[model samples]
Target: MDYGIWNVIELLGALGFFIYGMKVMSEGIQKAAGDNLRSILGTMTSNRYTGVLTGFLITAIVQSSSATTVMTVSFVNAGLISLVESAGVMMGANIGTTITGWLVSLIGFKMKISAYALPLIAVAMPLMFSKKPNLKNWSEFMIGFALLFLGLEALKEAVPEIQKSPELLSFLTQFNDPGILTRLMFVGVGTILTIVVQSSSAAMAVTIVLCAQGLPIEIGTAMILGENIGTTITAELAALVGNVHAKRSAKIHSLFNIIGVTWMVIMLPYVLDLLHYIWPAPETGDPNKFTLALFHTTFNFMNVMLLIWFVPSIVKLATRLVKSKGDEDEEFSLTNINYDAPLTAEVSILSAQKESIKFAEITKLMFTNLKELLNEQKQDTRDKLKAKISKLEVRTDEIEERIADYLVRVSEQQLSIESSVKVRSILSIAHDLERIADIILRMSKDIERGNKQKSIFSEKQNKNIKEIFGLVDLSIEQMITNLNGVYGKVDISGAIETEMAINALKTKMRKQHLKSTEKKEYDVQSGIIYRDLFFAAEKIGDHVINVSEAVRGDFGKDDEDM
Candidate 1:
């Protein structure tokens, strides 16, 4: 048997085509059902069982458990789902991945689906050219589905017949012993193969092909288990640059698979017997393929069943494993934003909306800190509070930039009119929150200047300033309420009234301050600083109104109070 360099290249190319086709198909489904996917994930994972079913359904639809796991991790990172729920989803994803194995065994090897790839593509081409977005997406899905099966066929053809290639079979035979050590060795090989290819489904296809080509079912099963462990590498890599929670989610995935593989390795023979009992292999002609598929499915299903009760324990372990740094260390970064998830424009808008709400909360905290900064009389405490405010301002700047960049990229996608409006609203709200942070920071600086000049406010002046801060805080609270959809409808009436009251208070304070300045109650410098602080505080209220208007999606409407 002469297997040369070109043969290796051809096999690699076929694998690449298969992986690429899977990606195309998965992305097409994501684009077509992105909104529904978001809704399903957001609403369906109420408990572990539901989470498992959600994970299974998503993986089945996307045809890639890796995609489902990655998306689940992203959801956790974004705070859309909890780690415990994600654990169940990850478990179900393990089961969902076996669908690929069953697919290969039932149809891929049993039929000549690739022969129809060209005709499928031809039939889908015109739909691909359709002006309607949904039709175009469906055509893309069909084209990718055809290409995927075509690639699978090519992969089967590219690998030289194991019997004809004595050297290759001989190499594989080295790890074919029934000892535990041999099984572990093959598991390592499987893990490495999956990591190299970056797709467990592709690895599964290769495993099935090898089994069909006379590789022992036991050896193939060992590799299949290895693929389980190997598949986790994707989530781990994704979490490397993510936040603490993202890392925890990824760790849970790794621990879940590794632990499941460990138990299966210990009970390998019994598991195999159970699989045979459930669905006995044919007496002859490559029963290993079916056997391996059943093994993959049973291994994952049993793993989920065994571990479902331990979800809290797993989440606790993961939380302890990945500790959070201090507040300063947890600066804003978009590394965990998960741009790689196949989110449609509509779904992406939901994430952006969540982030915008988070932005509002952060700004509200900044304002609370500003109040403390103003009240602090000790030089050290005031300086510390000022520094904290400065840090928060910098963080707000980063959040705005990242969120804006994310929304801009989302806007570039094929968005519906409503999604486009939501994107713009989120962008506006982010910008407004950022400006509010900036104004609060500026007010902090103005307070510091007043303290430096020994320009103490009179008792009445202090009362006026505190009153304005109170009104501004109320406005912020209302803005957050609107953003949270607590009422399910955008109502700006309260926000408008609050903004008007703030403006009227500022007017009255300005008049009293001007009279006091004329009477020489305080120096001109003191008056100027007083006016600056008042103006800055009033500006924050204006920005809060802007955020509310953005949330209401009525930015063009004139304020009735104005």
Candidate 2:
């Protein structure tokens, strides 16, 4: 407290830059890897050990266990990863996180490293100036690493001066008189900092560096505990914007970390003693930061080892922890179509395309409800069908929002050239799908409004409309299903069939409209509703054709206009 106020300001400012730099670095790494990290982690389901390794590699590359866990939770929500599989990945993430601690440890003590840090700036500057995104990301990594070391050095240098201050020394002495409550408080501090920062690696990195530089063990351990709790905040925030399953996945991550940290805190003295025993180098002259890094790594690895067998239990616990207080919101549940995972978002898009088709199938139920409205003469039955149709419409809107949001998040991220193209195609198709949703809603409203006027399609008109609408449904189903397959792009023989049939249907419907008009089939109001319904249906088909074309890579004129 008695240290120079200016020095204190400098220390805080340096630490702030360090935290900020780590953030930039972590985000760059994540954006660079994008969905590829999810894909890699998603593949490790059969073997627990393999999953552990996958998790580690992904977290190491991503530079944040919280990000990895949240991504894993997103995957879980999408049904891409089983709970058991996720646990293994989570385990690996813990161990992988140690890489940063080791990296920080290397940077913390060696004064000569700062010389290289300056060279990193020189090397990175050009890369930052380059036109390439990859190069920019490389620069970002460089600047982040440099600032990280710079901050740690400032903190270490600042600490020894504060060591002479009575107020700070007394504060350190108060915590050093350790016991169970004190350790829990320490864990509490770690959890709180991690929660606040949403970055476990940052918290851990600082803890290792500070402890190695002689911040008392009690203080360092408290901060580490806070880091674990803090990591969960990232997943919690992500899940809030996500669905129930996503929330549950985050819950699993948080629960597991809490469990690990809780037990570790209870066993604090013993665990710290174990680390000291395992690596006797820390107590020697010029304390080894590597020892701290090693301790963090092993503690998490051992926790994962101890708990992985109980994955099912953890899953059950997480589910209860994240229980829905009411019925699942259909809109969010419908989002089983996950576009972002450890795998590339594009690959996830392909996977989501399949899920979208299922949504289409669910959509066809709207037609069935419509048909019931047509056949039933009773007001009660009609009202019930109308309500059901309305409910279905609401569900579709929710689905569209969920999808658009997910894709939007993916869109904002750095994507590969190929992935970017795929995303464009996917976005185009999603637009088409969303348009179809519009047509469905319009159709529902039209039928209800038309029914109010008591107008029936004449025999010939009825037959033609049903036949054409049936074809429209068939084409859309095929289009959505084949979107990424041979049927999706290129003239998968069906393209010709689809184009011809849609054209014929359009022509046939046109003639039927002419005949209805010639016959003076109904009142002006009835005719207007009929015409609008027919026009809406045709437009839906047109959009479907365009989507299919977009899927097939026929994007020249249309996209250029946009």
lDDT by residue (tens digit), candidate 1, 1-562:
7779999999999999888788777757766775576566654459888989988887887788877787677667656678888898998889988998998888787879877788989998999767777777778788888888888898988877777767777876775547788888889999999999988999999988878876777889999999999999888876776778888989999999999998888899787888778887676667877888888888899899999999999999998988988653243433346666545454467667767776787888888998998888899999898998998788889888888888888878765444556777777788888899999888888989988988878888889989999999999999988887621247789999999999999999999998998899878887898899888889999899988887777652235412
The per-residue C-alpha lDDT of model 2 at residue 309 equals 80
In model 1, the clashing pairs are none
What candidate 2 gets wrong by more than 4 Å, as runs, is: 41-57, 69-92, 107-111, 129-132, 160-177, 238-247, 273-278, 282-288, 321-323, 328-385, 392-431, 448-501, 508-537, 545-562
The list of candidate 1 runs beyond 4 A from truth reads 43-50, 71-82, 163-177, 243-245, 283-286, 319-354, 376-379, 404-429, 453-534, 541-562
The lDDT of each candidate is: 0.81, 0.67
| Candidate 2 vs. true structure, TM-score | 0.74
Give the 10-residue window scoring lowest on summed lDDT in candidate 2.
338-347
Model 2 Cα lDDT, one tens digit per residue, 1-562: 4557887677667667677767666655654564465457445666667888888887788676765676666655555556677777877887888788877776567565677778988888888767676777668777877877777666666554435567766667777658877777777777776665456776776676566645677667656766767777776765675566677767777777888888877776787778878777634554546656766777787788888888789889877777665655313355544342333343344444544554565466676676567667888888898887777677667666766676667767655444456556666666667677667777777878888888776676567667767777777676655553542235645754775686777777777677777887756676776677667777777877777777665642345434
